[model samples]
Target: MSLHAEPEIRPVPPRPAYDGTSPFPRTAPLLRTPGARWQLAATAVIVAFPFLAVVLAGWVLWGNVLGPVDVVLAVVFYVLTGLGITVGFHRLLTHRSFTAAPALRLLLGVAGSMSFQGDVIGWVATHRRHHAFTDRPGDPHSPFRYGTGVRGQFRGLVHAHVGWLFAGDSSPADRYAPDLLADRSTRALARAFPALCVISLALPFAIGWAIGGTLHDALTALLWAGLVRVALLQHVTWSVNSLCHMIGERPFRTRRHDRATNLWPLALLSFGESWHNLHHAEPTCARHGVDRGQLDPTAAAIRLFERLGWATDVHWPDPRRLDGRRQ
Candidate 1:
């Protein structure tokens, strides 16, 4: 499709007449679609290759192939792309936690795209749907998907972490992200996702070659800064979908069956996104780590942007709202 061509937006089905049997509306199918093996294969490669790269990186570390430059590059990319997802995709695009300047918005979208997550629109759409359904049946990656039992939880944990990506039941961009679809710039960025993925790898490789002046340096940077970095961020984000709900303190009340939690160990890695309970409680809040002693780098970044005039109208936490949501 052409870059400027509008994305096809699937119509969200209208709610069926309520019979008072369930509060939850009858929703679209979760996983009955078939004949998407190509999509499944592609997802496997995207999910598996980075993991295999981590194994390769460990062996390379054993051989002393790892370098300080590679480590620095990895750290830099991780912070940039990680913020892209947390700040740009989740907060800005998905929930409108704040308004960003056009340039900053584009930059964040590109950076988040480089994180090797899905495109900006699809990511936002899927996440919005996740919020709309939460831990209920329509949630794309809920850990309680199977049931409350131990075996079901185990199966659900896997499904939530990575298995859901291969389920072929894609969230409809039209239904969930019509705003992005309507915007020419965002549409172009969505179209540029694959090329951005290549650049995500290439930038590190080129930087390493320029700095270290060797093919070995380039390849090592590709392995560490490119693939390993992606793998770490991928799993960290996935953990919020899996581990956060299953294990942690729920300090805030959420919708019925919403089990989002505050997993402190993941706060830094997820850029404070693992403060899942507060996020679900206040989806539009710019700060997920609202409580004292929580480190929220994503919120900090958004604050920096606001201070610099790149961001405006941030949905900073309200004490009254917090008090009401407290469990």
Candidate 2:
């Protein structure tokens, strides 16, 4: 009989420690609620109104009855609302490119409301989604989604410019914007979007009636300040999605698939958002136009806020970081 040898026991390795990081954490599934569809429909109506007004203005202008007051109202409202979206919504809210004092935050929220581009929360959620899935399947508005061919590109451009908003898929705010969702004040303002819309449309008429003392003045102001201004701002904001992606210089390198560009014509109107190539490369940076001679009004506003002690924690672009991203 052979003597049986005891089987050798191998020592087990110690279990890895839990460092509390996750590549893909558990997320709540997206909800396809009816409210989202209604909200989208409302958005479409608001976006379309400006275009309709523009056509009306062209007709009136050709008829040679448009007034100087109309021009003044349109110019004034356009600048106010445009700056609100760029300085308030994009720079201050979405990117936190800089911090703002509570009073400044409230004022910005109100000013942006005057733009009538939905409330701050919805805008931020949609924008964050755009960045998260830019030019990809989940992107809210990607001009390249349809394809690269001419016809496909044409269709994609339209989709990116404004068609995507009509689509009935609301981005889950919880998944993308927990910071905003957690803020009680912001949520309250967002829920008051319908009220904001009412005020946005009414304020111009009120101002015109008060200034000019006529129903004609009120109607004209409504058309010029409310409708025309909204349309111009909409296109400028949308162009960052369509034109900025389709044209301009790309000095900074980005993730291979991201297709942002710097189209200069849009620089002033978009409040320096046309420095899109740099924006896509460094989204959290307060200044999109980091290069010398690239004028950025939004950055200047943030700087002013900082100087006044109203803002802090600004994510200014570092030269070293720019060097790393240079093409």
Candidate 3:
């Protein structure tokens, strides 16, 4: 065998998307509407804890606020819970991109529940609705909802980033996620969402307390791993909706109004979801980063599960299919 590389694989071309209305109901207006009670409660914790951490860091911990252990704790939990959403709530539940062993399925579901995003049913409903409508009128969070103008774009960005959460508009699971709603086990898990959030936060604090064996250490751990970690991941995930849509390459052709784009900057932070263009074009593709050098940790995890006999039916991107999708 030769030592140096001899051949290279060319990148695949983009594809066109359907320009159509979402199957989700279009009854509610996307204005200043109230969110669900569960949404309001979760938002409070996600906001309050991070805010508190900042204040405490400024007033008390200062230089000692984020230590090595705190960093490790945050990184570990961040990857774990992040995968829970990307793999469990998204690829597996929302798209059925692949199948997994019974135990692995349960593990992904439980881990994803810890993200404080929403119950599995609700999250899947919203996401499926997103893919269905994309950047059109029914999209739950589209940066182009307002208009293409400057002021409108700013408003749309803010709305897409987080404002849509409070807009009272929600995907009807009956239409978007009937499959999940029909599953008794998934229903039970959705019911336990609130409890899972508690564990998500408390577990970090407990781990910190155990490792450091001090009040300060425990608090710092909670601040970094529990509060800061959640806040960071939240923004990164939302950025896909807000930033990715606004700028970057749109090599793939979605609906006339759809504005999904590929942002390489967020590839690692978003676990390959930043390849928004590819994802919007191929929603069920197990790997968003299909090109060479495109890092997709979530896809890698799915592959690992396949190797461990945990996941099957992996949908690695096909170049021929992709090549046919060139704009």
For model 3, the superposed segments whose C-alpha errors exceed 4 Å read: 1-49
Per-residue lDDT of model 2, residues 203-264, tens digit only = 88898888889997888888888888888888889999999988899999987568899998
TM-score of 2: 0.86
CA-RMSD of model 1: 5.7
Q: Identify the leading candidate in terms of lDDT.
A: 1
Clashes of 2: 0
In candidate 1, residue 107 scores what lDDT?
Answer: 97
Query: What tens digits encode model 1's per-residue C-alpha lDDT throughout 95-187?
Result: 888889999999999999999887888898899889877887667888777777778788889989998897676887778788888899999
- State in Å the error of residue 270, model 2: 0.7
Where model 2 places Cα greater than 4 Å from the true spot, the runs are 1-33, 62-66
Clashing pairs in 3: 14-325, 15-325
lDDT string for model 3 (248-283, tens) is: 998776767677899999989888889989887777
Better of 1 and 2 by TM-score: 1
Candidates arranged by lDDT, highest first: 1, 3, 2
Residue 156 Cα positional deviation in candidate 3, in Å, after optimal superposition: 0.2
